[model samples]
Target: MMQHLIRFRVFLFAALMLVLTAPAAQSLAQIASPYDVRLAYVWQNTVTLADGDGVPLEQTGPSFAFGQGARLVWTADGSRLYIALDNGLYETGGQGGPAVQVPGIFGRTLTFTHDTGVLYYLETTAPQDEEPGIVSFPLREANTALMSGGTGKLAGYFGRFASGTTRANLTFAAALYARDGGLLGPGRPTLWPSYGSNLFGTCCFPDPGLGIFTLGTESYSVWDATFMPGAAATNTTQTYLAGPTTNGVIRIIDLITGGTRDYAIQIAGGLGTIERVAWSPDDTMLYFISRYNPTTPLMLNVETRFPVDTSSADVTLYRLNLVTSTIEQLAWRADVYGISSLAATNEYVFATVVDSNAALINAFNTQQVAASLPSSDALLAPYMPQTHLWRVAVDGSSVADVRDDVWGLAARPIR
Candidate 1:
């Protein structure tokens, strides 16, 4: 029952195909501030060189950007890239060249084994129905292997998080699995029935969600859950966040004993919606990004949060003390619209700031994003918005800009 309950929302393949079939949108222009900002991105269906800072490296990509939703995955040593696209898994030449395409195949969430160059993808196909399972192929292969079978639902790629919370379970390759469209195939093997040793990473970083269901026009939260990575004794204790529905409450859950504790967060500033959440490396504090109201005026001359996109000035980064259950504002910039995609390591809280006016950029580049996209799903914006990378310490000190002119950024997952 525990395994069944946990297998609710795993692959999310429909989300992938839906995005693949969606129409193209706009692109964000590279920031030209004389400052170098580089990021690996799929442009015109080719694997282009991505630098952490915004700078063009000696790399080539496809003649046309992928015309659908896809994921760009790098080899362990960053020598090559496997691009999952509408056609199939496309390979890239790190130094810039035409992308190699495998005809008649489509994959979602391309990921690499923690220490190996082996590439795996969430493959779903028709007729067989169950064929849309987890499949893997090396850079040299045109043929693929069905790593695991599925009940025609989308699943997760086999990999670990950058924080070192390893995912080593060959049986359950998905670090955390859940269902969205509906309850997926029950008989599909959730654990590695055959290839248990073929998995990689730190093992498994499993997560449990508070059971939520909708009835008629109303919504009900029967449970709450949240998990943190820590020592062995602390790792099994997953806390579930509960709700005021109006404000919000943190529900700490115990994975081993199925026990729980409730703590109401006295959110500073004003009540806001939580988009992302992470914990301090020490497991003492919880951090989140929210469109929280400001209790006081923002500091001047600092970077402005790009609120123009949303037309609301309510994005704030907050931290909560686990022992005291007290929440406080860690940082905010009224100048920028809002904080997005928050991730915290022991050393820094990484976040993306919507700091630029995407509308004022070149129309040609915007057309590239729009024309190249498969559709205008919420995953990809209509126009690429100008974004910058920022990080701060857990104590909210050493706040600094890592790169500017970056429209999107992702930390290499395998450490």
Candidate 2:
């Protein structure tokens, strides 16, 4: 009888443990990782964030007016959304609350430090023709109306000298400022030297191990730049990498060691120029769009439509293997439009297209490239007749989904 009782006790204990652990395991399976990508969008004035499944997670106010040149910046906690426009800054909490206008901006790209919660903004008071500078505001004071009332020049320009001119006759060189107005280093100006040229777009990734990745325009090249840990000075070394530019090739300089590398892409039929370069989430591969004769006339001879091979106008997405220095064409569909502004996550890549009456978001997965070629249903979805921001997983499982009715789209891993 005691042996039977012991057996029953052991069985009961085993059953009890299984019952206790099953719910926790199922709960974990259902809880998505924070790193799992969710997209945010702004329609009219309201902003919303949606999960990979296209389900609405959160939505903000309808009073938040985002006109031209408006961009969204999610707070470090992902609980607040900061909408930066050419006029001012508007902020809305995550739970679809009322968006309040924060006073200090007069048209600049704002950068927020995830570490200190300090807000930095580039301030340029120079005439449209003169050199520009940058400035910063403490996070606590950022909400004030007169946050940038004082002209604090974080960096200044050193005039460029002409061949026959004295120092007095030299023109002030154009200046470029960090998106966030933080002191770059301990130089006399406390700012990094900027050539003052504008580039297509800016991407800022703050790394706890590596300092930061600042690319676009006169800032830094993606192919080069050895980012050091906890250091402000980029190594002067550089390498020249061949790029797909109008000239067929452009120099890629490594900001760190100042080393240069030469890279060339063999485009069939004719040489093409690169429209944009997008990096994978893991930085293992690079996706670039190249077009042949982009300026070729699309409509010819006033009335009659030109029988043109629009397929040639199609932007080809090529995956570059950074390790082997090899390039492969992934997709070549003529129906997709505006292939320039493409964003990639771990699961998929999203590209926007325009048809006769509506805009469509197309998705391509890295893993299922062979299967997705020629026709992609995710790309040919129920199109919306309006403009909006769309995102997709790079992995290909999650379909393309719309985020908001915003123009420019920017995303970073939620570390």
Candidate 3:
């Protein structure tokens, strides 16, 4: 009886998504591209990058209240910047103008396929315990709604994926969808058939050319679904797992051939757990941070594979070789305070350091692969306070190449 009820609810959710999406899909065809980066952070605002100078080309904001998380992607041409905020989806011109908001969602988590501009996100209606599912918002419908605030619904039904249970399991599941859209259409959620444990920390590379790849607590998995612009669905699946129960092994999966790769870093001592994983824009390397010993009040540790360990007596930055899967110690500072956040691009790596009362942005050049740290004054600058977003040049030209009030910034070539 329980199983039957669950299936019934899943079917209902699927129906809702289909009804909402069909019209939007039919009305819209192609999306323009060459988009700048879209940023959403804790303060519930959005911003866009204008040029390569690392400045806020244009700014838009206070769009929604509960924007817990967001992912920004440009269309293939870079003309439109799409932002998926918690419960709300929006897009704006590359130069930053009034953002168009897409309605009809009640949850967080957003992702987009750059090729087709087929927007994909997760949607959940009331009943906190019920599993949330994947939904599609056609670019045409979304743009129309954004421009005119038309009566048309912004979301279309895609399908439902599985979610995690406890906080740990929840982390894995959240990680899976962190970057990549959550698993669409379902059998048991990924990582469920085996461990019966909830998958946490989900992230994906949802390119049609690559299919979809996800990372979970025990391992990383890939699906066979090809997310072509206007095609019918194909078989969805979890292809592989980076096994043998270990903690803090941040794995990056390739969506094209279902390849599973692991980065074996002792991220967080055996304490709290690794929380964030970010991929470099070029998609060759990954950067992750782990908060360790959270149970102990005095000794809280924040560890990063980017070659720094904030929890130790000395703060150090490390260089990681993606092709070789190696780590080399680069720089060390005795008076380092705490790492607030980390961001990287193909050209440079930016680390936000928070000390006594001042916060700073540290920049590193990826071109210089050797493990020698740049001078502190040369690589970092005092970040203006109350600003969550900062932009830096990928070419290592000047730290002030561009400046904007963004909650988050990605220093990479936007496609």
Q: How accurate is candidate 1 locally (lDDT)?
A: 0.37
Q: Please give, for residues 238-325, the per-residue lDDT of candidate 1 as tens digits.
A: 2222222222555444433446675666654445655445555456777766654443333322222221122324456778787887
Q: Rank the candidates by TM-score, best first.
A: 2, 3, 1
Candidate 3 lDDT by residue in tens digits, 187-283:
0111111112222212221222112222222233333332221111111122122211123344444334445565666433331233223345544
Select the stronger candidate by TM-score from 1 and 2. 2
Off by over 4 Å in 2: 1-33, 43-45, 52-56, 61-67, 73-81, 91-100, 109-125, 128-154, 157-262, 293-297, 300-312, 335-337, 354-406
lDDT of 2 by residue, 313-388 (tens): 4556667766677777766434322332444555555443322221211112222223232221222223222233
User: Least lDDT summed over 10 consecutive residues: which range in candidate 3?
Assistant: 1-10
lDDT of each: 0.37, 0.34, 0.32
- At residue 313, give the lDDT of candidate 1: 48
Ranking 1 against 3 by lDDT, winner: 1
User: Pick by TM-score: which candidate is best?
Assistant: 2
lDDT of candidate 3 at residue 135, scale 0 to 100:
23
